[model samples]
Target chain A: AQSVTQPDIHITVSEGASLELRCNYSYGATPYLFWYVQSPGQGLQLLLKYFSGDTLVQGIKGFEAEFKRSQSSFNLRKPSVHWSDAAEYFCARIDSGYSTLTFGKGTMLLVSP
Target chain B: DVKVTQSSRYLVKRTGEKVFLECVQDMDHENMFWYRQDPGLGLRLIYFSYDVKMKEKGDIPEGYSVSREKKERFSLILESASTNQTSMYLCASSGGQAYSNQPQHFGDGTRLSIL
Candidate 1:
């Protein structure tokens, strides 16, 4: 079964500081990775995705993730984060085709001034 | 922009009562899905519809049923609502190509409470 693990359950970061959220996925074949953000009382928005070709994938709102094949990790990173960046982040994976995706429990990001 | 709309933002129902949660998409997406969101559980798929009148049971579908009479609307039904079923229900839609892994666009979600 394809699964995703987000190590950090909660992370607190100061505003304008760099941010990185760790994600590990388990899949037999090539994996499609994705990052999504959810605001309180709102639906999820896609941050980025990794299919093939590029190891480094850029997403919306100044976010990027690198897909590491050997380590089975696709961590999201941002050089600088704003206070509005505080939200719950989820990492998901799916095998080839339009199948269902398995998501991590999510990491809550807290930004402080 | 794709817009997935759920009929209600919040709903309150009594135990053993029949409940219906409606979802509609404006993008004419061929794939519509229903998922329940809970703390620690993240999101669990309840049902999925690939096309009109075609439905598939997802990871968790024991307490729920679905209807997809039209291409743009998919409905989730609870035969007998239970307190355990109280959670945030989200609706999403995606383009249904065989090998395309398009991201699913989500709705605002419906928070259902069962008494």
Candidate 2:
């Protein structure tokens, strides 16, 4: 079965610091990868997605992700994090056959002042 | 912009009672999905509909049923609400070819609590 793994369960970073959240997937071939963020009491919002294109894809909220086929990883990165960036981040991949998503357990980002 | 609207923001019900959660989409999307969000589980798919009156079971569909009588409306039914069923339910919709990769638009979510 195809699955997404987010190694870090919780990450605390100082405001204005760089941020990176790691994600790895188990699949034979390159798949459609996505990053989503959810704030407290709110549903998820799409951050970025990677399909058949350049390895790097930019998304809303000044975020971007790189899809590394060799590593089977699609990691999210931001140069400077803000206090408002504190939220839960999920990594997901489209199940090509079913058009459904398989999401990771999620990484909770806490931006400290 | 695609707008997915969930009927309630929060709801409380007793065990064994039937529960109905409503979802509507304005973009006339071809796909609608139901998922439950938990602390460690991230999001688990419950059910989905590709078209009107067509339903399919998802990863976790036990104890849940779905109805998509109209293209714009998809409802999730809990036959017997239980305490373990208390969760944050999310509804999402996506347009375009079923086989193509499309980002799903999500609602604000409904936090359902069963007593």
Candidate 3:
């Protein structure tokens, strides 16, 4: 079975500091990878996605994710974190022959000033 | 912008009561899905519909059912609500194409509680 794993349950970073959230997947080939953010009481917002080419993909809100086939990882990163960036981040993938996305357990980000 | 709308943002129900959760999409998407979100479970797919009157069982489909009577509307039914059924239900929609990837659009979600 295909699955997504987010090792870090929670991460805290200072404002203006760099942030990286790790994600690993259990699959044979590189499936469609995605990063989504969910604010308190809000639905998920797509940050970035990786399909076929370009290992490094840029997304909205200054977010970027690198899809590493060799590592079986699609990690999300941001250069400078703002206080408003505190939210839950989820890594998702659409495995082969699946129409729905399989999501990770999610990483809760806490921005400290 | 693609918009997926759930009928409720919060709901409270009693045990063994039948419950209905409605979802509507304005993007004219060909695919619709229902997922339940738990604190540590992330999101688990409950059901999916590719077209009207067509449904597919997802990862967790027990104690639940679905209805897709219209192209823009999909409903998830809890035949007998239980205390363990309390969860945040999410509705999503996406365009369908063979071998093509389309990102799903999500609604705000409905937080359902069974007592």
Residue-level lDDT of model 3, residues B69-95, one tens digit each, is 999999999999999999999998999
| Residue lDDT tens for model 2, A1-113 | 89999999999999999999999999746588999999999989999999877999999999999999889999999999999999999999986665888899999999999
DockQ of model 1, rounded to 2 decimals: 0.68
How accurately is candidate 2 docked according to DockQ?
Answer: 0.74
lDDT tens readout by residue for model 2, B54-89: 998999999999999999999999999999999999
DockQ of each: 0.68, 0.74, 0.59
Fnat, model by model in order, equals 0.62, 0.69, 0.40
lDDT of 3 at B3: 90
What is the i-RMS of every prediction? 1.6, 1.3, 1.8
Of the two candidates 1 and 2, the one with more favorable DockQ, higher being better, is 2
> lDDT tens digits, residues A6-91, model 1?
99999999999999999999855888889999999999998999989989999999999999999999999999999999999999
Task: Output the better candidate (1/2) by TM-score.
Answer: 2
Q: For model 3, how does the per-residue alpha-carbon lDDT over A39-105 read when each residue is reduced to its tens digit?
A: 9998888898898888999999999999888889999999999999999999999876778898999
Question: What would the TM-score be for candidate 2 when compared with the true structure?
Answer: 0.98
Cα deviation at B18, candidate 3, in Å, is 1.0
- Give per-model TM-scores: 0.97, 0.98, 0.97
Best-performing candidate as measured by lDDT:
2
* CA lDDT, candidate 3, residue B33: 92
Q: Worst 10-residue stretch by lDDT in candidate 1 chain B?
A: B96-105
lDDT of 2: 0.94
Q: Clashing pairs in model 1? A: none
